[model samples]
Target chain A: MSASGKIVIALDGMGGDNAPAMVVAGADIARQRYPDATFLLFGDEARLRPMVDKTRWLKTACEIVAAADVVTNDDKPSAALRKRRSSSMGMAIDAVAEGKADCVVSAGNTGALLATATVGLRMLPGVRRPALCSFLPTVRGETAMLDLGANMQCDANNLVEFAVMGSVFAKSVLGIDAPTVGLLNVGAEEGKGNETLRDAAAMLRVEDSPVAFHGFVEGNDIGAGVVDVVVTDGFTGNVALKTIEGTAKLYTGFVRQAFKTSTLAKVGYVLASSAWKKLGQRADPRRYNGGVFLGLNGVCVKSHGGTDALGFANALGVAVDLVKYHFSDKVVEELNRLRQALGEVPAAAAGGVAGAG
Target chain B: MSASGKIVIALDGMGGDNAPAMVVAGADIARQRYPDATFLLFGDEARLRPMVDKTRWLKTACEIVAAADVVTNDDKPSAALRKRRSSSMGMAIDAVAEGKADCVVSAGNTGALLATATVGLRMLPGVRRPALCSFLPTVRGETAMLDLGANMQCDANNLVEFAVMGSVFAKSVLGIDAPTVGLLNVGAEEGKGNETLRDAAAMLRVEDSPVAFHGFVEGNDIGAGVVDVVVTDGFTGNVALKTIEGTAKLYTGFVRQAFKTSTLAKVGYVLASSAWKKLGQRADPRRYNGGVFLGLNGVCVKSHGGTDALGFANALGVAVDLVKYHFSDKVVEELNRLRQALGEVPAAAAGGVAGAG
Candidate 1:
């Protein structure tokens, strides 16, 4: 937030596939949604100025900050940090850290964005690590999942913290009251899964813990909306999320193929097009575009690099919502409460929490 | 195969949801497909005799073995092993171990089945553990994946063994020529995943490696059919497989809901019913029912406990195919070749390796 209490968003104009244009256009859409919000467009001014000037209200809404370098998709995170600190993605994160902007939204290389954001903004006071979290649509409603590729492997404390972060996230974003949290495991039984899971489950099961622990949930439980929050180590969570996306595409292709099989089927598809459109709208990947970096000092969102203007705008909306809800403050409070409860159980301390798996 | 060159299969009659009836009926169907394959049905003779008698050809094709006990689904693997040795599920596994049957198919408790099978048939030479494998429908064709919940965590050597085991299974079962292998990891890059993945990849990339290692593959690649075999630690493989199943169900539900919206949709759904039927047939869970326990000394397949008669029969087919192709002997050959290649790399030694993740 700025001195005048207006929400200021830093945009990485050169980040995504259709850069500058997509960034500028997405900002234009977001401007209408949050009229009080201001923007800082960081990229090459020569290219960004024209793109901003062409928008109806973007010229008055945002200012183009000059940045000469970029972090390409193929660039390693370590290399990007060393060589491209002056890149659009880096500058946007810098703006958030320096309080020049309220939060940062970048559609750049995920590893680079994660590294840059964590380094620049720093972790929250008690957070050992920040996890990538996002809400995925389920049959009943949206469910928030965390540690989505931020840490490939995690410990008991890490998972317990994610549950706290994700529970707060679900409550704030999904508007669910006392959201249920489940540990993603191979089975739903109490004795099932690795030592990390068992330890995490023990911690969560304690009375007065921050989250409403729902015990263990399997992969099928994810789509069934079995819990409001699904927490796991990054590698498994990332794989599950990508597998869901790929399976959706595969099944959708099958549906399309089935419709094209015969003349009668084609006619039926045309007559039932509205329902298909509704289904598409309900399950649109674009609507769930942002990957929110939780446990950071400030709001940081990573949009899908290949997303279009609409998707980018949706990512911006996620940042706006987090900022509006004072998500970070709530997370700190929840973490404190969780830690206090965990303190009663000495085994949950970070030093004793390395996973046997 | 028996001394007379006839295939022998042992069936656990009281294992699945439909139990003795489904097992007997499925055997009747299998008898038609393989006239020479004799079944040894292990269960209560009172229940099994009637089911076989009711079937047209099952009475002649199968011999009922009286086993009073049965392993319940709720029994733990360790408990089942201790107390249920005389149980039908146990007797079925025993027959294979004693060479009275060439293979066994059980739709009983999964954990119990895996534990009992491993103890009874034992692991093949050079195999540290047995892996659960199953082929899933992909965009191009089917992709074989392992070890689906056999080992919760895996090291470099465990994964290398799975690659060899999965490669041989794909060639023999899916009939894919010289099946390409992929280590299921968080990313496709060489430096992406944890130490376990890196070590496994290094072993696979060697000059004289037995399997065709196509670098690393992500979760999306499983459905994209990027490789014929995907090898991973049991936890991730199980989660990915179940996620694929969940996503397929979620999308299929969406397709069905779209056709239930209005009068026009209802008419369209009925007219396009054939397409839906065809689509259902293409993605039928029954057709992909069996979960093959690879690296075991004998052919052992686990059918879905909830599956019907047709599904159980499909599992029988998998066991029959493996027996006919001398799967166990071929696995030994492949494992020897893989071990020889890995033997040259001193770092690939099991005692020296453990995953940092």
Candidate 2:
């Protein structure tokens, strides 16, 4: 938090498909919502300054930090890490680590952002692996899921860590005091999945665990909002997330095709357009653009690269909310409490686990 | 094949939620469509005879085989197998294995059916494990996906086998001459996913492979209809399949809620009722009710346990289609060709690989 009780957000202005234009436009939108907040914009001075100047609100609220290099989405994580000192994405993350900014928001290459943030901010004291957490729409409400694509292959311990992190995220962001957590598996039965999920379920089911463990949940349960937090290995999580997105698009396409089939349907579509628009707004992907990288020492959110100004603004809003809620600190405190209750040493004291690629 | 160029299908009369009644009704519907086909109904004669007598078509075309025991949905696969000789589910499968029926359609416990069928019918030559294959509606059309739940953990060889089997299925059932096969993965990039998927892609991309390999496809591709067949390990496949189903239901629920929000929307829904009905029929779960158990010596289709008569009839239709097309023999032929092209010895000569469970 800054002196005026406002949070400072570091923005990677040169990231995402729209680059400085969307970033500046998004900051302008966010500025209206959070009048007290300021931004440290990192990008090429020549391109970013003009964009910032065009937006009166952004010009007043943002300070441009020049960086000569831009990390393209095609850059590998290792390549991005090698250029951390000079890249806009890297410098933005660095500002968060140095405590100059409360959090960092970037519409950049996901792999690059995760790599740069992990190395720049480092993992929290008791956290083994950081998970990429995001909220997905469900029948009940938005549910938070973790390890979306962070650790493709995870052990029982890693899943346990994710469950804890996801629970904290749901609590702090979704405002669920004691978020219910369900391990994603093939079936709801105890003996359904592989050894790793079974073992993780056992650990989560313990009385003193931080999460309100709801045991195993199948894939359908995710969309049904069976629990507040859904935990799984990154491979399965990533696949499931993408599958939902794909299915949504597929059905929407079907609706469009149906409307075009006849003159009566075309007229009916017009008559029903208002209702359909409301449904579309509720299912908008832009509203759920931000994916927070949990378990890091500082707050870091990755926005969708292809998103527009509205989506980027929503991403900024997420950063603001997390900072205001003291999300990172709360997570650390929860992990420490959990460790003590389980009679286990801090991850740092136990020799910190290797970071996942 | 049965006498007079007809196909024989064995029905488990004691299976499904509304057994005997639904089964008899479903058989009557299927009999009307496939007038030349005959059915061998297995269940307690006392319970099945009356139901069979009530349905005019079923009474004329079906022969009832008495089996006193029933495999409850909660019954373990092992327990179901123990009662193989006495259980209706087992006897129906046995009918296929013993050459009395061309295929078996069951609406019983999935685990029990998979277990009993694998034991009763034995594995097809060169197949390491049986895959639970089914069709899912995609934007372009319907696509066949395999290893939905069987073979939870699969190797490269097993995935290749699934691809071959899925291709044969699409050709025989969906009527695609050169059905393109895509490996279901986390990304379209070659290097994405675990070692098994990578290895499977390598094998699938070989010049002489039976199916037309379309390289890698992401979760979204399943719904996009990017290929005729999608192959993946059972765990991911099952998760993806269920996720799609859950999402479809979620969106439909949203649409329903939206239509009820205002008077205008209600009128619009009424006007658009025809289009909505068409979309509903296209997206009907009943139309895609059956999941065929592939890689076994005999053909067996599993229907949804909770499905009504219409749904059960569709499952029976899937069995009849497969039998009429000689689906089992084609799969075996494709696998044998695939093995020879890869310079691998026949599975039968090498002693067929053990079943997954």
Candidate 3:
């Protein structure tokens, strides 16, 4: 495949439990799947050669960009960003910032990536802080849930910006025109939710929202899919995400144990293997691997570092799609419009002031 | 079941999915299951008679208290409390308030029940607002997650009160001694959570905390059983509860589809029936039906209104247990001690605050 007219994504190869092998395998899969997309793998070249030799696609379609070391899960976010200058994640982000790659993908450390990306790419013109946004598969449909874990704390203005950015991301990537944005609160009533969301709801109600702002949504309503964007402060959003993941795991574990309890059940399991695999595939970690860090100057996709080859492949696909869709530009434009609407004052203004927004 | 030695629990026979039938059946089950318990069924004598006639044990162990009216699920909370003066739920609570029954158990409209109990029984001294607290099963153990769908908005003081009340309830009812009270934040760091939690954390860090106070806990930590009492403002707490419930439903649904996929799986399904049933029983909504409204002067157990006989029975058991364990007096005393330690200033010193409990 020719490099011309192709989007280049810098993939942090030395991240995740599967690490170099999964990254290499995923890169090969992406190269075979999307001939128009090229991957630049950032990791130690010596460790990657074995997998590179095994795949024909990797030889021509993908390229290896050598980095000295890798970031470990044990490292603190600040220390890793500061001390690990030659780490794969740091180099991958640098590649995007230096104009060598259109976007960056990493499964390494979410906090480290957020910190480094914030320092490396810098926030956009009107963006105060970036939010980690992901598409949650809800009963109503798929919707964008913003600040899934990025900022631990946020004022009402921060949430307002999150709504705007989430709206644009959904419109551009999810292809939802005039997406309905909802503030994740305790209830759908305007009188519901915390003080931060209550004040933010007032802003969302009257202001010229970038998206179709649809009042407030409760946690159960998240799956009901009343809106395309669910805006929340990082703390609540993070808890919501983890709770969903944990509950899913626990329920599935119980079912698996149930199925293996009897000999007759073992026979049923054999016959049902294919259908079970299909269902598992539908709920696979790979299918929803990439979550974008919005409100930055450039695109940055963070995949779960604990994923396998399929997950890494999905992350790369997300990076390529994000670059093609120009995700960052859309988010930046929305942020600018929102800032212009709210004036030059800090977005954190109305958090303590209640209805100031 | 002799009346003198048995614990007496009043049940709202007109509440829940099947109304008098489920209530009557549940009361019978509880009576037979625990010989030392008696039930007072409060509902229309005509409607409850046929259901009560179905069981022999209920005839002798349960007494029907005549109530002329019913509180419909769709009625407005305030209107239900005002207009339905002789409703089953109202009568059951009244029995407790008048010291005729040790506890009140109702599978009635949650909002209406909460409002009625608050107005009729009144808040305990130093209890600014009451919270609906329940236990959500997690991987490590059950988490004491509270204010689940209670007050939509809560301030720092309200959170502090919830922590104290939840701790006391857990200790007295759940038999968890010196429960580690944790303020649920986005992160475990002291300064991590939102402003309300941050302020609450500061107050919780004081030497005079009513329970064994841990600094902070995250969403995943809830399932990890790192803390005995997980405290948060109502908005986040409600969202977290619903999110876990929704995820559990989604996962279990997927697993059921997995089992019924093919012919051989049919055999496995039959063999696994026992294990599946056991697992199902563990995750059954009926088993976890009741939620206690803490901070009130009397024991009020609210079960899901749309519940089966098994669920209603669980609710009755919860009420009986709370009464036997003296949940109300213990929690109220803890709240008073906490308030005194914090140097409970008059309402004037506390200034303007919404949901100040």
Candidate 4:
């Protein structure tokens, strides 16, 4: 928690499709919900200053920091890293690195944001790589899934590290005390997936494991909410995440088309509009727009670039929540705890060690 | 196509959750739809004959082929192969290989089914490996995706073979002519996935390609119906398929919960019951039960292990349709065409060649 009783959130005002307008409006919306939060807005001052000035809430709560260059969505991570000193996205992440802000929120290019954050804040000790973690809508409210697209190829150790980080994330952000974690595989069976997954599962099943290791979970288990945190290599995680998003959109489209097929259907749709509205609210992707970069030294939240003001606001809320809960510190502590527990076993016998303890 | 007007479908009477009861009931249902379709039921004749005889439709449409042993769902592919002479699932596939049946349908162990069919029927020339292909519900209609869980690892050539097979399967069963195929990847960009995927995409882009290659598509495109055939390695394909199924179930669960939340919502649901029913029918997992084994010399469809009679019936329909359309022959022709088109260039320069021609 901040000593001043107000959390500082660094905002990349020149990122995303709508850029300044969405950033300004989203900050205002977030400000209303988080009265104890302040913003360090980074972008082209000429464009962002007017937008902030027009917004009554942002005018009072945000301070604009001039950044000449903006990282475009098409910019590769390597290219974005080279422009870190002048890009708005880079400056926003730097605010977190410099401890000027509690967390950074950017509806920017995902690859660029990840690259900037990794180089700016650096990875936490004992963390091999940072994973992109987010809350996905599941049957049991929402479940935290990680490594959405950070490291495409992951070793068993990377997956084990992800399990610890994802567990800490679920607890800190989703407020689950001892979140159950499951390694995403082709089947729930012990030997279902490739060697990497099997090895990761073995590590997670240790007695003193940080997460409540739930053997192995299949893809269907993701939406079933079989576990609080679902861990996977970035390649599989990204595919599953996008597939869920796409499937939801497909179903929604089907419902819309079905309603318009006939007059009776249209009338029925009108009658059930209120109920459907509630369902839509509950399943809205905007409410879960933020993807937190877990295992980083500082809190970094990535909002979807194509999101609207509401989505961006929700992402900002995620950053605020994470900072308030000290997510990064907790993750570091958990990882250290996991390493200590695993280190006790003899190095040569590590592969044969079964339990987390 | 089958020489006779009647398409013979070999039924694995001992497979799936419901087993003999569901198999008999499913055959009766399928018979009602396809009067020309006959079944060769493989299982314990003592148990299956009694069940089949009790049903008027099954009694006339199905013949019992005695097989004492059943392939348990957990049986390894190697173990299943050892029991090829005795297991019901094996016998069912053998019928197809022996040309006693036009096609075979089983709701048995996927790995076992794939292994048995591949060994029994052999892969069509030019196909490096057989792919597990199935219809997935998409916004436009159902799209055929291959390598659902057959080959966990695949090379670029294997992916190209899958693309050809998937395109042929789509045309034969889904009745889509000139079906557009897309290589499944992390991103749609030319530089987006692993080297193998990039290489496959390069091959698919050739000017005279047998299938209509639509370049790369992300996970979301699977449900968006961006292409008629989505091709990928088994690992990614299986994960994506199950993710879609899981997400759909999650949403269905949400709707059920929402409608029960309040009395007014209950009333709204009653009024929209008809529309909701239609939506349910369209999105029913049972309606899309069968997964076709492509690239094999024979037709084999794997149904959901947990599916009921209606679902099993749908699986039977898939096998019948595939046999009627001579799916395997079409796939062989398409692969040959693809190979010939690529063969125009020097053998050493084949991989670097781009465009269908």
**TM-score of chain A, predicted model 1, versus the true chain A, to 2 decimals:** 0.94
Q: After superposition, how far is residue A32 of candidate 3 from its true place, in Å?
A: 2.7
Query: Alpha-carbon error at B357 in model 2, in Å?
Result: 43
Interface DockQ of candidate 3:
0.40
List model 2 lDDT by residue over B239-300, tens digit each. 89899999998988888887787777788777777888889889999999989999999989
Q: Candidate 2 DockQ category?
A: medium
Residues B1-357, candidate 3: write the lDDT tens digits: 124657878788888768878888888888877777777889999878877888967788778889887888877788778755698889888887888788888888888899998887888777788899888666665668788877866888888888988887777656788889888777776657678888888887776667788878877677666788888777678889887777776666666666677766656666667877878877887877879898888888888878887888777777777777767767766766666567774333333444555
Best by DockQ: 2
lDDT of 2 at A46: 92
> CAPRI band of model 3?
acceptable
Report lDDT (Cα) of residue A294, candidate 1. Answer: 93
Error at B350, model 3, angstroms: 25
Question: Best to worst by lDDT, what's the order?
Answer: 2, 1, 4, 3
Using Cα atoms with residue i matched to residue i, what is each candidate's TM-score against the true structure?
0.95, 0.95, 0.83, 0.93
Q: Evaluate all candidate structures by whole-model CA lDDT and list the values in order.
A: 0.88, 0.89, 0.78, 0.86
Segments in model 4 whose C-alpha atoms lie over 4 Å from true places: A261-264, A344-357, B344-357
Prediction 2 TM-score vs. true: 0.95
Across residues B1-357, which tens digit of lDDT does each residue of candidate 4 receive?
A: 355688888989999988988989999999999999888999989988778888877789888989978999889999999999888999999998898998888998888998998998888866779888899889889899988988888999999999988887888779998999998888888988789998888888876778899998888999999999999999989899999989988877777777776676677667666778888899988998988888888888899999999999999888887777777767766666676677743433434346536
Off by over 4 Å in 2: A346-357, B2-4, B346-357
Q: Native contact fraction of candidate 4?
A: 0.60
lDDT of 1 by residue, B165-225 (tens): 8988998888887999999878888898899999999989887777999989988889888
Error of 3 at A335 (Å): 6.0
